[model samples]
Target chain A: MLLKVKNLNAGYGFLNVLWDVSLNIGKGEFVALIGPNGAGKSTVMKSISGLLPPKSGTITFDGQVINNQDCAVNCRSGLSYISEELNLFTGMTILENLEMGAQMLEDKNKARENLDFVFELFPRLEERISQYAGTLSGGERKMLAIARGLMSNPTMVLVDEPSLGLAPQVTDEVFNALRLLNRQGLTILLVEQNVTKTLKFSSRAYILEKGKVVLEGPSSELITNDHVRKIYLGT
Target chain B: MNNSRSIKAVEWLKSSGGITVTCTILVALAVSIHKGPYVLVNTLVTGGMWALMAIGVSLLFGVMNISNFAHGEYFMIGSLTAYYIMHPLKEYLLETPNSFLAFITPVLGIAGATLAGVIAGILTDKLIFAQLRKRNREGWLLNCFLITIGLSIILINLHMLIFGNTFKGVVNYWDVPSLALGDVYVSVDRVVVFFIAMLAILFFWYLMMYTTLGKKIRAVAQDENGARMVGIPVNRVYSTTFALACGFAALAGGSLLFMFPSYPTVGIAPLYNSWFIIILVGFGNVAGAVPGGFMIALFQVVTRTYMGEGWENVIPMFLISAILIFKPYGIFETKVRSVWEQ
Candidate 1:
């Protein structure tokens, strides 16, 4: 297993969000956690990424117990988490923003290589390299955020709500990019609301409701499960 | 491509870089023509010192969101540090003007002053600001202001108790003759101070522009949580930033020691002047503070020289108030982020 969460319970101040949420992701697997609004999906991602401290239980990544490690440390250790809001530095140029993502690396040549790879993955970013990030369109901004995550060259990527507030076509573009990355042997844990599309792309799926994992199985089996179809799939 | 290309020119003009250059050149021209070559040179020297202090003030304010009311106290501490350092070396420096000791003594004094300021700054962050931040309660903005104001009071009284209420000076240059450039009588020591200030400013500029630390500082300033998410140590950055800002303040204090009186309340004037420069440059823009300092210093020099000595203090206040009323976004067009959501 590349990442494991056992009996995890976490939340914000005075409001518990995740409860006994045990999950696992194998190396190079694309796993999706799908749920409705306020179902505590984001809280799970936050807890795993060390953005929020888990109330109890352990988050093990690459055989190391990393329950309360700082978010930056988690990032440096090759567990990249992309928040839903896509927090790119608006005042900086695209190149500068990418450089910030590659900031932890000691080798300048490696940083340059990462930069070239990001540019290759997202050519639009290269075209607008000199332009300030604030001016980029929604699709481009999302792409830049994902591209920045790749600059760190993580072992696994945890993305929260990649399709939120985007047009359908832009949504497809983002997922396709993630799918492409997963195919290239990067492990991914995705928390998303778009169930049908996510299930189609993911190798496995977990259905979260009210902070608990109600169902978990292969995407092919979950797609046919009656409870998933009735509640999440809106069949 | 064409649209982005066109917008790039507009962005450049609208950016802080455009205003800084334009303001500097325009002020240089006006001072030279109206105040003559001598006054222009004098203004540049003094303005350079004020600019250094303002850069520190604005950097802290921009990054940490603290007005740092004790900034003046840091300046006071800096000047006093230099005074005490020079006190023991005064007799030696006076007798050995052309000797290596003479040259090294002032350098030693400057370094001592800077180190003192940096220590004070680090302690302030660790003892006060860091505590406030750790508590992480609501209304931190107001809390920072009130705490810094209180710290300023404590520092002022502490300095009085330790150093007493006497004005001190480096006695080596008390009777030394000044070099003359036409009608302007430029003090040799002040000239050395000016060159050192310029070099310090350039060094700061380079650090912010091309360094990884600078990038981290900018990241933390833009978004603390985001920076942490990306693995930058936000707390350490805050402490370093405070130290750097106060270190620059000390540099200004050290440079101005040869020309200005060193007293317990000596920092008040520079502090007030830095506030004016920061405001005129606009908040949240560190680079703009440099040219902004130059603008205010020129105003003071010209007003005091041409109008009257009384007008020196009064003019800056009036000018800053008018600018605030009319163009509160500042001369560089920095956005007022608090007024409306983006």
Candidate 2:
């Protein structure tokens, strides 16, 4: 498995967000965690990505236990978390933001290669290369955030709520980009609120409700599951 | 051509009115008090140092979001170091008795002072700020303030115990004849100190505005987590930024020591003045610190020269309080939300 979480229990200041939340992602697999608002999906991503410390249980990525590591270490270990909230340095230009993401790479050549790949992946970024991230629209900022995450050339990308606040068409564009990235052999764990769409795209899905995983199966099977349909899809 | 000239004349007239009013007030006060130009010059030079110290404090707090109560200690360390290097601490330990070393002492003093300041900054970050950061403490600003205050007290008392409370003077490098330019008499020492201060500010401005390191510091200041996520070494940047702030404090301390006598308690006046200057300059804006410092210095000088010694205390207090009440960000307003937007 590229990433594994077993009985993870975590929270903020005594408020537990993830209780016994277990999930796994194999190498080069596109997995989605689809659930309602405040379902602890993002909390799971935070714990796995090392943004929030896990109170109990273990998170192993590529055979190495990474639960105690810092966010920077996790990122260096080839796991990038593109948070739902806009995380771009607003004062910096698009190029500077990309350069910041590639800071750990000592070689300029490798940074340039990543820069070129990100720019190619999102051409709109190239056009607004000199513009500050703050000036970019929500959709552009989201694209910039993803492009920044890709700059490190991580083994797995954990994206949280990429579709949030975006128009339906823009959401489709972002999902398509994720799918294209998955095809390029990068493992992706997507935490999303767009339940039906997320389920349709992923090979496997975990339905989270109130901090615990209620249902887990192949995406095709979960799509037709009665409980998931009633609670998530609003059938 | 005639119309354009008229427009230009109107714009110039409108802008010059504020300057004229200020100049008129200064003249009236100067005439009424009838103080010597020497005292006025002294106040101006001392005020400049205060402003410089304030700039450092504001930069650390406004940009880095670290309170750094230990900032005053850095200034004190710089002043004491400069004094010892220039004068040679014969009372403390064995003296080298090298005449050449004595001649180059001021430069060595400044260098030593800067080094001490840098060391203090690094130690604070490693021992306190870094630990707080790991625990996910958001009240680092308050903690930093407290830590720095404690450090200042400890350093001051230690200096008193080690160096004693006696005042010490640095050997003036430029003790040449004074220049008489019209009614204003400028001392070579003051001129050199003033020029050096200006150069240091210019150097800092250039570094912050143009360099890659400056860009990274500003990026981290904007959003530390965001910067970290992008692989920027946030802790490293924080330390470097703190070091830079201490370096500035050291420069100001060295310059102040050169102009005046130093005591263990000398840092108190500068620290007090810096508080006003920090508020006078828009928080986190280094460029504003220069003008803010100069303006406050100018005000202090003119007030002391024209009104009396009492106005020296009253003017800065009133001006700073008024400015804070009206524009808490200082004379220049920076986009505060931009710092948190990331």
The numbered model that scores best in TM-score is 1
lDDT of 1 at A38: 94
**TM-score, chain A, candidate 1:** 0.97
Worst 10 residues of 1 chain B by lDDT: B333-342
Per-model DockQ against the true two-chain complex: 0.61, 0.49
Candidate 2 Cα deviation (angstroms), residue B160: 1.3
Residue-by-residue lDDT tens digits, candidate 2, A1-235: 8899999999999799888988989999999998888888888988888878899999999999999787888888899989988578888899988887887777889999999988888899999999999999999999999999999989899999999899998889889999999999999999988888999899999889899998899999999999988877889
Chain B TM-score of candidate number 1? 0.89
Task: Evaluate residue B206 in candidate 1 and report its C-alpha lDDT on the 0 to 100 scale.
Answer: 87
Please give the TM-score that candidate 2 achieves against the real structure.
0.88
Candidate 2 overall lDDT versus native? 0.78
> TM-score for chain A of every candidate model?
0.97, 0.97
Residue B99, candidate 2: how far off, in angstroms?
A: 9.0
> For each candidate, what TM-score against the reference?
0.91, 0.88
- What digit string (tens of lDDT, one per residue) describes model 1 on residues A1-235? 9999999999987889888999999999999999889999999988999878899999999999999898899999999988887777787788888888888888889989989877887788899999988899988888888988888889999898888889999899889889999999999999999999999999999989999999999999999999988987889
Interface root-mean-square deviation of model 2 in angstroms is 1.5
